[model samples]
Target: MAAGRAEETTLARLPGYLTHVALSFVKPDLIYQGGLDLSATGLQYPYSGTVLKEAIALLKARQPQLRVLLSVGGATYHGWDRLDEAALARLVRDLGADGVDIDFEPTDPRCVPVDGRMRCADDALSIDIARRLRAALPRPHVISAAGWSVGAYGEGAFADAPPRSPWRGAMLALLRSPAAEGLDLVSIMSYDAGPSYRPDQAFRAYRAIWKGPLALGFAVLPPANGGPRATIESTAATLSAVLADPKAGAMLYALRDVPPGPPGPDNPDYRSLATLICVTLDKPGCDVPMP
Candidate 1:
């Protein structure tokens, strides 16, 4: 189960709580560090030092075998331009993390290029950072990024526009870069495309451009209206359809919205969604199976 938020104070306490939750309720083999937004550095989202330390300590204590990664950048952060190789190396060394997740959205308006033409600086910064992190870290660290929807990007829409679509060509360029050589995964924000969006659309998008490991991210809340369950069924169906294609798995945008149901070793909705993939792909640790 990938956590969405982790601060310095909460990081230390997370390992134990996660372990207890996993052991007692749902045992996820992998957990993504919620995130430490770089753009939030000095803003309202000032970086949390305690969260980072506690997160590291928790991984060391409760789930050493569990893969723990740090997600850098987010919807609001766009300071990737300032991250050089040296700084990235230091970050990896200090954090003792296994990998980094880049979720920077270019359309945030805050990322507007001073000279226009959507500068490649952000992409370059990410590649350099990935290279440095891989070199400094002894273990194979992961480099992941989240992209926009295919239709939106393919159609040539503005970056911040609704559906702020993913540019397939742009993404492919990043994947092919020297720095991306160490990239282990890529998660696509498949939600909010439109009410008519289908799972096949996502599959076709990835099949057309990506040849690496992929994970689909679905939102539990509606794109415009904050509601529930709009994603669970579709997410499960999408997982069932794509599990056989070397796709890693699916991730719910959040755990908080997961519906409340039977109180056992599993939440039926989560279990069912996870089961569809495990059964189809035969992934042992994809998720904790239903009883």
Candidate 2:
């Protein structure tokens, strides 16, 4: 049996609860290239920039235990090979943010079924950097990874009704690696796989090894991203079902970016979903919406 299903998650080792809802996507490439004031770009990254610091300060003020993480990638992100982990940690510290969410979406090393197992070319990079991140920012500072929907389809052990996704096993290395212990959370990018992938099932597959705070992510993305459109009803059903697990969490892909799709706007979404997550698990701080 996969450990995520069989093993009783050690609550003590994992976070007490996933407190922060994770305001995302502070583009590492831009920060790496020096983009302290993204607000200057005028409509590039509104949630980020100098305002991001204020956001963090406000979140912390609301709940001293809250952790505001700076998400670092998106669907079109690149240049994982060159990410300076040290600089990233420093940036997190500088921003007054609690930690970093390594949202890596590399194009290469797409894992393939190989020799009764799955393998990717540079799979080690995921955990290697995770370990580095954990080392750089120890306890109380959270480190999480955003996983691909069908990223854990190895033939044996890790297998769990694999979906027909563009990249299979792309994230298995990180989850299965020993370094995964260094991570505090792993949010599954459970959308964007079209009809073949079910968000709930993807969450189940990941539960096999990721015994920590495993979040089932929701997205309000554009049609250009190429996925079945998300309705509040669907998002509600998925979160309601998956969040039944005590360790399961709710994560929105973006609450700030003007997602180019209908119903992407945050009105009923922020209200309903945030309320649902709060009421369901009794997680505090849902009163203030995600930024």
Candidate 3:
């Protein structure tokens, strides 16, 4: 669920909805708190003391089996620098979460230098944080990161093209680095691909370099250039194809955008597609049908 801080007020209302409304259709094994981007909240780094503790208590009480994770450093939290190792270790111990999700995007100005170099001093810091957290935390928790897609990363064959940008090589280097080895999953943000959004293009671009589990992240919005339904259908078809490959899975970009509303279950938005995938995937021998 891509929940906002406001939604935390109504967090209690979720379990019933999950059991009756959502689980009735799709059984979600994990629920990542849309964000804990402490940088946005004007808090200090390694937020484990008050904020993360409360988040863990609230989420764990609702569903024990549901792996609750805290997502840090989103597109907006770019100015965030290195985290103190002691503070990070404390955070990992305090939160007792299943893992953390690093979602640093390149567009964030804080990462860009006036000299045009990608300021990635924080990358090494993050990797060290993960290593310490893994050693300190009692159980082996999964660490993940959200990355931009192949077109977005501009790596492998998509290095030079209309979608290619200066940030592509830097993004690819980050993903391929040993720093990313501790990660359990790397979700690729594939929201803004052009009108001719083909999943095969993405598949071909990433298949060679990525040896780990991959998740396809996409948005439901139509293109400003005029293709709306085509974009949605293409994304769905692409995702379905990706999921057919054992190494890939589909992750809806958000949940709030696909609220249950008048458009009904057939909507191609994130929530609907997520629900559809979860239900079909959880049940084997159940026809993998999409509405």
Candidate 4:
């Protein structure tokens, strides 16, 4: 059997080869209820920090190689607009996460420029939050963020019309800031673009500005209005090529969207996907050498 296939069987049994994988638990709400951040509230999340600490301990004990991060802020997270740094740090410590993924999406009317000029308020917030989170959190903890594609600068999807950008200011500022030095990874959300969007091209564009470990982000499911769906094999191939540089990695948009099924190792769709990510397995076929 193929190496990933073999591991898949083992993972289904022992379920520990999953150590090679990383997962994110999002929006525990640092400011909710006066800083008593809970994940199971309003969001209807049965799996929140309410049981996360214990869960992390158990998972880590079994796998000893599993990695999990806490994602603060989602599509409509206003609390992140003016973050409470101390509260956020405390939450990170409490969860015992590998790091924090700032999922702050800048869409508030307030993010609009003062003079109707281009600007990304979220980008400014990203730099500040990343810097503070990096400093506040203990050493060796990851500080990562989900960013829009270079096309976020308003690259026109069609051939016609002048290209405009709303986030150009933020993008430029982030590239210029020394504060970005504290970030461990910058995963670019490369979706929501016309069919012309290429992962390799997007990777190159992000590399030009932010000189850090880059993780190419794509959707496992078909995009609603933009781009094409990527199959597991194609995603694996793309990730393999990107992983040529040890510092780079690949990220799927989310876990919530995956269809309900057996554990990742047992489910064919999840297993096939997990196989490509089982880098720590150190098994043949799992190591997708650069082509």
lDDT, each prediction: 0.47, 0.64, 0.47, 0.54
Q: Candidate 3: give the clashing pairs.
A: none
Per-residue CA lDDT of model 1 for 103-141, tens digit only, reads 655552222223322324345654565665566543565
Off by over 4 Å in 4: 1-29, 32-44, 47-50, 108-119, 151-172, 259-268, 277-291
The CA lDDT at 227 in model 2 is: 59
TM-score of 2: 0.78
Per-prediction tally of clashes:
7, 2, 0, 0
Worst 10 residues of 1 by lDDT: 20-29
TM-score of each prediction: 0.60, 0.78, 0.63, 0.70
Q: How far out, in Å, is residue 182 in model 4?
A: 1.0
Candidate 4 versus the native: TM-score?
Answer: 0.70
RMSD of each: 9.0, 9.4, 8.5, 7.5
Residue 136: error of model 3 in Å? Answer: 6.8
Candidate 3 C-alpha lDDT tens digits along 1-291:
223442253222333122111110000112223343333232332332345456556756765655555565565454334433244334444555565565555452233333432344344544554555445443466666666553233433464433533344334444556655666776676656565545466654555556788777655544444433423445556666766668776556554454333454344664455555564344332232222
Instruction: Give a tens-digit lDDT track for model 2, residues 173-284.
Output: 7888888988988888887676666788778778876788888877656334565666666676778788668889877655433454334323234344545556555665
Candidate 2 lDDT at 194 equals: 69
